[model samples]
Target: MSVQRGGLGRVTHIIGEGLEGRIANRHLALFGLGFVGLFFVLPILLLIPESLNLGSTTPFESYRRVANGIYVDAFVRSFLYGFVTTVVTLALAYMLSYFLAFSTERVRTAMILIIVPLWIAYIVRYFGILLFLSPAGPLADLTGFETDLLFTTPAVIIGLANVYLPFAVLPIYNSLNAIDEELVNASRVLGAGKWRTITKVIFPLSLPGLVAAGLIVFILAAGSFLGPAVLGGPNQTMIANVIAQAFLDNFNIQFASALAIVYTVLLVGLLLVFNTLFDLQEVLGNI
Candidate 1:
């Protein structure tokens, strides 16, 4: 009888401990959610009222402006730039990641030489392109080319690529590092060439990083204002640029808030698609 009572007590203690653990975990989760709600979610929610208020004087007119064609144009342009930038950045980062992962020590040294530009300040690096492509800058002086690249579509892309390349690179590099070497060796032993081995065995395994880097670059490029503002002219304006102009130039906080809300929705939708495709946590494992 005593033994049975002791067994029952042990079971009861285990159950109580589990219950306590669950309660503690739930409390921690709620606290974390509250923090996020206060900091991140609240500010976004606030945007809705500000965006919808129209104005102090003209309440009905604000909604009309937000639905105008200009915002739609900016949205489309922003998405286009983001897409192109994401593709180029992904390709370059993938190549660099592959080289860094599999190259011999001497090759790695050469690869590092290529990657060193990523350490430079973004504005400085972008403006350097201006200098290179400007008619009075080095390229015109040396090569005798008269065309200027400033304020062009390519300039915006280059600026965005320079700024966000590192974001793509690190994730891909970490994924490459996590690859099993034996698989590559086995592919080679089975009469696979270097290209074949990489395509067949390496790239398929790096899908997680590919998805991660692409999504990250997409998000950063999509939301970026500085690069477009500095490097682009009227034709290259983006959603972020319009939003900034709304706030700073026009003082249309409500319309800017609306644009911002739309931007947030776009990013959220993209992020959801990405999270569904690949686990960002798994992709960014070591980075």
Candidate 2:
């Protein structure tokens, strides 16, 4: 029995020693980087060659087409909708999160309600919104007001904002909740009004989560294919819809790739601008 115990100890030591230096924090990055390289970077790089007509005199023709007319409008609409949706979502989420953090006696109940929608698929929720907003649907049937909201720009923005609101709420709530109550007490005791305290103290401290939420919602909303396709009109068409139509409907792979590359560049450029304005490295570090 003693010999068997000794043998087990030696085996455990050997296993521990083998794992100690072979696996590390940096090694985890290797695995992640490998996956991103194979799946993300490789695929995006391949789009460049696929987008070009290698031997043709007008190899750059697809890019030229992408720069003009409806395609340009699609790109503009995508960013515009994304920006508007982010703004609306943040305002609503911040107000809700502030209430949940400070005023609520049932934070768990409120959070569960907020999170429940996220479990429902995006398509299902958007379709439900479609039915609710349709002229013959509930708003008209119950209220006697025939609404023409479906398949419009406002409808698309509302759908995107609703779909992404839970995402914004969770982060902002965390930031607000993590704040020390004493700071708030001090602000109140120092003669600051409720509105002034929120503006001066609470809002500034919550910027980290606000920025994180904005980044997430903007990226998701901008690249959305289903929201605009399901809820928007021709005028509200976005970049993702254009890309999908080119690839799936028209089977113009080169043109689709050009659209994709341009969209990606624009999105990244916006993120760079956001980071410049917010100093994301500094802001997100707190969160």
Candidate 3:
């Protein structure tokens, strides 16, 4: 009888403890939600009112002006630059990642070399590209063949690709590394050549990582300021530059806020399309 009572008491104690743990977790979740609401959500909500110029008769005037003006060209240029950067970055990163994952014995050393550039300040890195591509820079001096590249669209694309290459490499390397050696062996045993095995098996499996890396690179390139600012001419200026001009140079807060709102909505819509096209949850899980 005493043993039974003791067992019952212990079970009750465990149940109480579990209840307390759940309550604590609930409180922690609520606290985190509250913090996000206060910081992120509240600021975005305020931006809406500011963009609308609320309590005045002329609401949405800023949005109409932005939609009809040269800002549309800025949006197109930004998307073009972003697409070019993503393609270039993905190509280089995939090659490097494949070598590191499958071909290299000195993976750690190579990875360190790849990651070292990230430690440098972004402005410094962009400036370095500026100098490197200059008419009098090493590339020009080495080849003795220099046309104008400084402050150009190609320069911006190259700079963005170089800056975001590391981001693409890491995800791709992780995905490639996660691939089973047994699968490669099986493909070989099944009379598949190395290239065939890679194309049929390895590449397919690595799609998730590729998607994740591509999306990340595209978004970063689209929104980047430093790349265009340091390496691009007036024609290369992106939507971010326009937003900065509206806010800082023109001091048109309503116009800037409207641009920001539109940009955010477009980004969100793009993300939704990506999620629908590719299972972003699965892609991120692979990463």
Residue pairs whose backbone atoms clash in candidate 2? none
Q: For candidate 3, which ten residues in a row score worst on lDDT?
A: 1-10
How close is each model in CA RMSD to the real structure?
9.2, 3.6, 6.9
Q: Which candidate is the best by TM-score?
A: 2
Please provide, for model 1 over 154-273, each residue's C-alpha lDDT reduced to its tens digit, 9 standing for 90 to 100.
989988987888788877877887899999889999999998988998998887788878888998898788888878899889998899999999998988888898888877887777
**Over the stretch 199-220, how does candidate 2's per-residue lDDT look in tens digits?**
9999999999999999999999
lDDT of 1: 0.83
> What's the candidate order when arranged by decreasing TM-score?
2, 3, 1
TM-scores of the models, in the order given: 0.78, 0.91, 0.88
Q: State the lDDT of candidate 3 residue by residue for 1-287, as single tens digits.
A: 35555788889988988887467667878989999999999998888888986777878799888886589988888888888999999999999999999998999999999899999999999999998999999889999989698998889998999999999999999899999999999999999999999999999999988998999999999999889999999889899999999999999999999988998898889889989988888777766
- The predicted structure with the larger lDDT, 2 or 3, is 2
Off by over 4 Å in 3: 1-35
What local lDDT score does residue 285 receive in model 2, on the 0 to 100 scale? 95
